[model samples]
Target: MDQVQESYDEFNLNFRIEDTVIVNQTEMEGFNAFFLGNQSTCQQSVVEGVRVLSYKIPATLPLGQFLKKQLYKGEFLSILSNILNQLLYFEDRNMPIKKVLLNTKYMYIELSNLHVQLIYMPIEKEFTDCNVCEFVQNFISKIRFADMQCVNCVDQILHYLDSRLMFSLREFYTFIIELQKEDILKDDIDLGEGETTVLQQMSYNNITPYLVRSRTNALIPIEKTEFLVGKSSECDYQIPDNRKVSRKHCSFRISNGECYIRDENSTNHTYVNGKMIQPGFDVMLKNDDYIRMGDEEFKYWVR
Candidate 1:
């Protein structure tokens, strides 16, 4: 997605075309290259007594209307999956994404199946003025999730968008897929990939989790299910004045009496017992495990 960008052609027509000037009627025929035939994804039509051509998606509501209302987490994920898959398809075909409409109103969806359909012009110019990030920001704002996993995911996405100067759709798609997978595997953090969640509740009410600074012996209690450690002030445990530490470094996920540590792609990386842990993969912490984030060291304490 980063490799594709829209550049202006200086030699193109600058003068405006008059209303009476002959224009290709096929230009008004929506996506697919065929006439106003109802098919998968998008439908095209013209209302009786109306001169203007139209893109009509039958049996679906505009995403703006479908959204801006209460939606389940599953519905949200389905919509995103459909849209991103289409964008990826467009990218593969070398189609001009700028011609693809990103607005919620232009995108259609069916609530029951959470189907998404986007309008794309085949013309030799960009149709919509908005970018993908702007559309996503607005789209995300309207979504309300009932779970902490989703809430945390939304916060992380917003933070990522704000911190970065340039946004890539492909990168965003990967991050979103990770977020979705993480959400799906939240209950089964101990399980391997493709494993099912057992959904048994573990009683850890008597026990608590905490961390200790190895050098200073400062005790910091693990208060949240998802705890953050980084150089940024926003983190729960901020390691100050560390150039090697990323703004949002490692994360601690306390689940079912076990503490899972994740390396958040930090520069110097995160370690467990002197071994470098893979970034983005969660490693369960044991009693008195030696954990290192950049130059700072800590000991995971659970009782």
Candidate 2:
């Protein structure tokens, strides 16, 4: 019965689109011809190669009026489907959507229930994997208020939504872009026919830990064998303003190309990715891991 139920559940699950669309020989040939023809033009002007699409839908049309119109709901759904499909297509191709603008004619969509306009610009890059819809959804989910203003500027929209969200989004986007660049650099350096690059070998030999301070946006390279962290001035990495931080909070060190952090028997203790670690016990550090010392938080990056 359990196995049967599991099978039924699996059958009912709506899977996310993950695979790229397969093109036929004719489609491929046409794409090649188009690419070759436009190569010169695209090289000359980058903006000309970018595609921008926009759609407007009456979201606030009264339910009664919409029902009376008969095909309003269908039309609305169709437009939304097209937008989603375009986003998914770009995502599959690893293309960055340059911009996505959402507007409701200078009125809040929740208040007016009137209309929604979506403007999207998709720009193809040699290597980019940004899902515009996912970013929008993630950003929207962080909005504290149900009522949102119809704003043209993405930064303005975020400002109206939440400041914390804006800061977090900026940091996250930067981190992702940096990671992508690192991956691209690694590929360029390492990719060859049966040849291992020196950079690739060095990556395995060395462990470089980086501490990204949230408040100051300061990036500190961890080169020493042991780095002390605390609120006290005596500590290596001092957070004097942070009252929650103990005098001698914690310490981190790199050993055999692996980074480890050990709690230093502090008042508030040390945490890695939210879970508190045992005092004096060393925890192995991973790339892009979050570390919390008392009330302060730091993003750890190992390169």
Candidate 3:
């Protein structure tokens, strides 16, 4: 097995709890208010539900003070509440819940919409045995879901939770890297000598350049092969106020769904995070990389 897969397996085996209680659809009605209507009412139901569920936990299991310290310090309660609110929102909106699995350490909510599954694990050593009720109460009270359509609801919730949940961002970044590696391997195996020779030209033709403006925070989706960035009126991305900017600053080219920036040999030059790229040479841009032309700065991102 590859290192990534091996690490993933190890993480699951060591940190994950095996047993889970699957909540039935018929039993979902009691929590309708929690999902569909009033926030206060929904929160109350969640608190009560967690208390009942806690009864199943083995009292003989050793309780450590360290665990309690971790729970209170981190955003475990907040994360749990956000997840429950999202699940309830899904349930109330007629979004099918394929399964709701509750374990001692985590909750997995599976939705029929896109077959998306959200796993929420509380921070280790954070919850004291005596603090479960308080945790639940805090979690429920903090939940405030905005009214949004079910289509992108899961993604929106996951995006919000990504910032709060520990290990989530790292896991997601690792998954993306694995996917990119697999894509490269597949490309290498499937290409013929003649086809491979033309691959770069063909791939360049198929690319779409997507960028985010740092100052305005606007998304610029580029469908063209080449995009010009400068102060000139003809440029695709114009920086008008920056006097240090040249008339034609830099050029961004889309190749194989990837973006590359090349300095147009402007007076002030172009840089990626303070590192100046030699004129006429392309610098491949990655997500969250800062691109600077003269004194003006922009952040590069892929959608």
Candidate 4:
């Protein structure tokens, strides 16, 4: 196996936990019967009816075996394929869940008007362990099917991907999502409270809703940074000065550390921590680094 493959194998074998949380009897019952083949039996009786099924599952039953019944063979196949493909072809980027909440108000009415009955339970973590548990959680957490027709949300996702001119829908969607995470190492980390954390500064024009920085010095735009953070190694900003000033410049050289600032070579110079830096000088920054350009003064933080 290649070195990357070997590392991934090691990670899967030793680091990541495969199981997710699962609760509920119906799903559990369906899962058991599907996997154990309805062989071992148990019994149940209600006010109106009696049902016989497998005896209580032994506590020692393997999680993989339990989930095997609850999860489809096809689901297993697809997950395995994706994992192998990602390991082989893509750099793993940190990402948050891509969720689509169904519009229960209007869409449900429309479906009901059309006599289309929809029933779906949101995907939940299975209590039992399995290799694809994380993948399952990622998939289910990202998808929501309401009383409305399933096609509606799918169409929206497809259109969004198409609008981006994504060559491969799956890969592009995944990459975009991964790149959109709030970077802890960034000069500006907004915790959403009265407090702010600045890891680095972007140029004034590159300012984004989630971050505050000057864009005039920004070597790259927030849109591109939002999509390229963890996936690419191409540097957008260059250090004009060999002299390191403060924590900001040093962070940029470290792995996973990133910052944005206006270049001194341009018409404007980026001032950090009340110091006006000249062209070609590198500055190190920490949380709450104060930057000034012209009349504007801003603070950066980690959110």
Candidate 5:
């Protein structure tokens, strides 16, 4: 049984080692830097009186579990593109490429956005024997395509990888982009608004959106792409002296140039217009929309 403790910001995925020796903060931080996703921060703690190594997770499914659901061409490309992109990221920076966990059990994915998360141990020089070539081959062997009548970019990549002994990250990425063209852009996929509250994709890249507090008439700028709001000091927007507000209330995030809000399972909940939004879910905000966090209200402005 894998025991994970959930905090407001992130959940801790703990691994109990057989050594029984407590993992210090240094080792925990090193291990968690590889817990790739929205919440990359690391912390060390004890759970159930046992010494364990823990890492932050923002609720993603293991790649193996996620694959069990109906797989589409768009989703298939998204998953592969993300993994290849991660390899590219590591390669371009000249970072150690072995830190990327190649196995499906270690890899995670956010189904909503089709974003991939990889779990690796940065501290270990020899974490596993898995390498880029081995992973690529395993990935190819993992799944059988539904249709083989027509060749696609995916088939092309499999053929490309098979033909070459030396794998080049940039070359692989370039080939994927060239083959798919527009399909390579994962954001273009229609995440049906009814099922998921996807934020509005910015039409006018010229205009930047902002917010105005209704009470003080203060102008608030979006400083970060993911703007966290709450009464906690850790939040980007720290609301003070508000008993109705939770420490980590909600967040406004700009994904792929579009903006949206998510209720962070706060006690009072978040309201757009008049109705309260579901916790841990997204709600798209438009220009002139009123957002209420507890009693604090702000008018979203796009101009």
Candidate 6:
């Protein structure tokens, strides 16, 4: 029964489009010629031996109203089918173009309810060196999300650069949510608001999920290690405890070889290794690392 239910859900998502444009060939002076009845002229011309197609769609009536009527018979899919066929025909020629511009000004005239986005071909090499066509093809082929192994969703372009190029997380997360429904790093990820968390319930000896140095809370992932240090918030000359837990609610633990500290946004800044962190900065913990937060100081020892 579960298998059958899953099959039903799949079928619902892969719904079929019934309407489509019928393409036909015609004898012409240049490369190719065709027409949709007597409504518009479709001509494929070669300029300097490069094949290019020029077609026009009539907009005698307002396009917005016309599209509203067309949607009743599922004409949208039919139009897409026609456009896709033309693209495939160009692909068969073995000639590549940098960008394909579809005139959608008339589309806006009749199709108020529908929206269109223009995708340019031959993406910038600076951004991953993969063209827009390659990006789309990769998405259609071997892309999967929702995995610890898979780093990025196929629907979005993955351009991994150093932290220097990292943009605002807000803008990044917005783009991810559009391509993939889940954004794990979102600020409001918790299902419900609570006074205390599971980390508080777990014993520090058994599982220390977070570390505090200088009041900054750094979340510690299991099997990761980090460094510890101390410094004076009021004066640089002053040093704090080497091992400090933030807020008494959480402690840091290292399982593998990375150190981590959580930000409780304390008055004194936590300095991981040598980098002084703001309240929210998640400090990277490393083995034998130096950390100084507020009046606390510590050298991390790997167990």
- Compared with the true structure, what per-residue lDDT tens digits does model 3 show for residues 1-303? 001111211211112222343433333344333332112111111232232121111122111211232332113323344444555554455433323322333321221111112322222122211222223334333434332222233333344333321122223333333433443554577555655432121111122346677767877765556889888999987888888888899998754334678999899989898999899998766557888788777887654
Candidate 3 regions exceeding 4 Å error are: 1-208
TM-score of each: 0.47, 0.34, 0.33, 0.20, 0.48, 0.21
Model 5, C-alpha of 216: deviation from truth (Å): 76
Model 5 gets an lDDT of: 0.64
Cα miss at 18, model 1 (Å)?
8.4
lDDT of 4 by residue, 170-228 (tens): 44335323322222233255567677664332211212211244544333323332221
Model 2 has an lDDT value of: 0.46
Q: Per lDDT, what order, best first?
A: 5, 1, 2, 3, 6, 4
Clashing pairs in 1: none
Prediction 5 TM-score vs. true: 0.48
Least accurate 10 contiguous residues by lDDT in model 6? 8-17
Candidate 5 weakest lDDT stretch, 10 residues? 198-207
Residue-level lDDT of model 6, residues 131-154, one tens digit each, is: 323323332233223343233333
Candidate 3 global CA lDDT score: 0.44
Task: By TM-score, rank the candidates, best first.
Answer: 5, 1, 2, 3, 6, 4
Clash pairs detected, candidate 2: 60-113, 60-114
Per-candidate total of colliding backbone pairs: 0, 2, 5, 43, 0, 40
What Cα-based lDDT does every candidate model obtain?
A: 0.64, 0.46, 0.44, 0.30, 0.64, 0.33
Better of 1 and 4 by TM-score: 1
**For every candidate structure, what is the RMSD over all alpha carbons to the true structure, in angstroms?**
17.5, 22.5, 20.1, 21.6, 19.3, 22.2
**Best candidate per TM-score, number?**
5
